[model samples]
Target: MPKKGTRIVCFSPKSSSKSNSVTKFSAPSRFGLSPKRPSFSQSVMDRTLELAKPVITKWNPETTTFAKVTSLFHESRGEAKDFIKCVHNLQKAMHLLVTENPTSDNLAVAQNLMQISMRRLQKEFYQILSMNRAHLDPESVSTRSSRTSIQSNSTSDYDDDDEDVDEVRVAGDSIVQVEDESSLAMADLKLIAECMISSGYAKECLKIYKIIRKSIIDEGIFRLGMEKFGSFSSHKNKKKNMDWEVLDMRTKNWLDAVKVAVKTLFNGERILCDHVFAVSESIRESCFTDISKEGALILFGFPEYVVRNSSKKVPPEKVFRMLDMYTAIANYWPEIESIFSFESSLPVKSQAITSLTKISEYVRTALAEFETAIQKDNSKSIVAGGGIHHLTIDSMNYLSLLADYSNILSPILADSPGDLPESSESPAPAISRRFAQLILSLLAKLDGEAKLYRDVSISYLFLANNHQYVVVKVCTSNLKYLLGDDWLSKQEFKVTQFAANYERLAWSHVIESLPENPAAILSPENARECFKRFNASFEQAHRKQSACVVPDCKLRDDIIKVNLLRKVLPVYREFYNKYRAKMGNERSIVRFTPEDVGRYLSDLLFGNVGSRSSSSSNQSSPHSRAPQSKTSF
Candidate 1:
């Protein structure tokens, strides 16, 4: 008899019955001689049929309950084992009969018996597969594959002694019993499949498997909420009709679906295919490709369809979703390659690569459009006090979020050449160059917006405010990593330069009103005229600056205020003390004491801080003046 799991090839019978050769045999000399003993081939055939017929007949689909709701393996493992053993023996018998009695009546009988046995195994194979749907589901099968590996490795570490064997068996028994049933079902299917394929019934066996399992995979993909993109009528029309909100939701669903499909759905089917057709590499590959190819194509094809069906004028906001899909494919590529490893599965692999390429293209296109949008911004409304522009806020916000995807975008940007210069100092050079270019475009646009301010000083303040806002945004987020310390330091220095320009333009004439040397002892007449010029310049500078605003507290207090005090205060104090006494009765010409100048400077740059009072009291006493005290100056 053939050993279990061995393939037995059936040979075609030779047509010996048609030969014209004649044989003559001498009649036995003794009349009482026993009739010619049965031929060895004849006895072998008789014994093989007797052993195979009863078991094969008992398990016949039409005659037994095995074809009904019962699983042969689950109903009685002994009978199942006996059935498989009989099929193997029947195949062996067929091989021998074909070789020994190629034209005998016994060969025909053995061939017919072999057919009956294979039919029985085929029915059992389909029945077990149908019955064990849940136990053999992809997720469960994937789990089983891992557990099986662990169990096999664990079993190998033990000695072959009976005590060690029993310990291993008991430990196995402690596992979830459902897995054991799944293992038994898989083993039985493998046995039947091997027997049928070895016996030349592979076509029938593969037909049944492909039909049943392919449906399961299709349904599995559908249940996971993957939609068929072809159902949409026209890619362009679909893109125009579908709003961003709907596409966004679908993209999210695809993200979820692809992970499960690769990790559990296609992967599980691959494992099951490899196990059932373990005896044939070609069959395993063919089966897996047939079972998983269509679904995987659809799964991987989703992102490309999304790119096609998205508006050609893709929204800047949608780039992240595109990157998300790209990252998902890139992240799970190894598993996809392993599961669909067959040469026949190249289309599925190609589809995945195409999707990644398409998504990267979409991201690059979206980024280019975003930069163009920033450059072409043409809002006419001026910011009230040369504060941060709305364009600046929006552009910085978009760039900051883009920085969050630096790792994903790095390779994508590297592949697409850009007009921007590369910075080796950056961690992700391609992304950093692109970000810097976009920022430059935004700053250029902001420069135009700053011109809307009537006061040159306020224009400087607007640039300073917006630049400081951009620097802060970069410093606080992932943009810091991509843009690097050098970029940040330069941006910060630009902010300081802007602030200095504002200070010079707004207050230069006021500081210049005082003498280059404040201790110069001018005659009383010259002192009074000097005091008059100094008071006029100081009040004009204060009233104008009071209306302007700075948004950042650190920029307003630490940088702007500190710089103003350092440059203007000490000089005014020395000029005031020497000149106030010389003014004599013309004390009103020294309208602002050194103390009053300090008080007014504190309120500058906070928008409209004292504008109304300064205007109303111009002819009256200076409203910002503290009570006169020689001790205060």
Candidate 2:
């Protein structure tokens, strides 16, 4: 006889006085064979189809049939695998019938049966998955075990000869253990995904991928717990076996859903920015939780199979990649801006900025985490003293990207008064002032970050460079519209001030030795002595200031020299011209003549000291001596 749950398709001989023949169809291996077949009478064939038709029809997606499938396995004293195979047999039998008799009178019956049977196959697969998932949890596993025990005790009511079948079936069920549930679900999901993808349901495949991803991520997050996110994690024992590679691979796989969604949403026609944002939000929520709370820490990176102490902080590469992913999806400002620039695109509601602002907050959090980690590392002597210099480069670039959308970001960053006007009628100048204020606030934060460096001189230099960079970037871009000329003037002035502060901190002694009045002399001897003092001071100042390093060359030439030499050089030249004639043949005592000083001053910054011979190459040209009227800011 066939296995109890195996499907048997029996066919009776055709009419017209033909031989009373019997035909039996069984899927050779997947389906068990019948040892002794009953005579295939017309009534028996009809009864077989009658019994199988309702099973196919009732096993549908309209309702949950997981319990029914579970009951079938228990009632028949068969394994879940056997029950599922029996369901597949029904689908295969109908398929065979359609292929064998496409032109026969029974074609419609065969085709409809095949259609329902295929659907039942899908529904049964999901039912099996659901059933397995139910028992995956510890509490549910205990409950299922108790329930199975009760069912086993009552198996005697079915048949005495079936006790051995029940025992074998129980042993088989035990093999579908808790640890194997996720693997089983993953296998089934891959099959379902292949079917969906081949059938042109890419979005459905993506949905199944999300389910598998979430299960993996939730388990990983639970294992890592809340401590893995910390800079100085204390749960050392708990993290000893933490597998970051596994977490990273799971994250990468989860992120692939985004590609599928983008393809589905944008494959055929022009998609609106609002719709893209909506879908991106859905992906973000599924892939990562709002990690604002303590329990969830973002873990995103390429999978690297290296063993390290788990209590050690999460690597910057992982943290940075996590932010990159967040920026790509959750903070898709570039894509949104590009689409919205087109007049044909639909307008997004202003409220969309609220969600975008939340993403902005995440970016801010990421930057903060990076700064904190760099600072902590520097403090521990594990890193260089001036690490903030490197940290600020990327942080400043990210801030610049964020600042590009100042129209929306200003409202978030600016401190608005409670009695302020409605968003629409607010004056342009007021918004400009708010944006300018926000930029200033961010610049101040950058300054604070730079101070994390132990070297105070390098700290100030860092501030000067980044501040100048931001002011220049803002002034050149569309951001200038919201940060008006006055704001630009103010930021430029601040940059000038920072440059001055840096010089004063490093150059005050160079200035102190200059003669108080070298141009006014009583006699040739006094003029020569005063000129001697002036020459000594100027040469020392030139040498010391030239050696002082400004990391950004353009900023060095532009702001530093524009502000410093505009005040110092003209006075020095006037003193030199007045005294050189008074000294006459002793003029060679002055190391740098007025014209020589002019040429030398330009190259002082580059450290190519005094080698030029052309008078036109003098650094103290009229343009250099006068106030620099056209500041780039």
- For each candidate, the alpha-carbon lDDT, in order, equals 0.75, 0.43
**Candidate 1 collision pairs:** none
Question: Could you tell me how far off, in angstroms, the CA of residue 4 lies in candidate 2 after the best superposition?
Answer: 20
TM, every model: 0.84, 0.39
Q: Write the per-residue lDDT of candidate 1 for residues 196-288, one digit (tens) a residue.
A: 887878888998899889989999988978745634354645335467787889999998888899889998888888777877779988988
- Kindly report the root-mean-square deviation of model 2 from the true structure over all alpha carbons: 19.1
lDDT of 1 at 572: 84
Candidate 2 accuracy as lDDT: 0.43
Residue 265 Cα positional deviation in candidate 2, in Å, after optimal superposition? 11
TM-score of 1: 0.84
Specify the poorest-scoring 10-residue window by lDDT in model 1: 154-163
Candidate 1 regions off by >4 Å? 1-43, 65-69, 146-172, 230-241, 415-428, 515-531, 573-596, 610-633
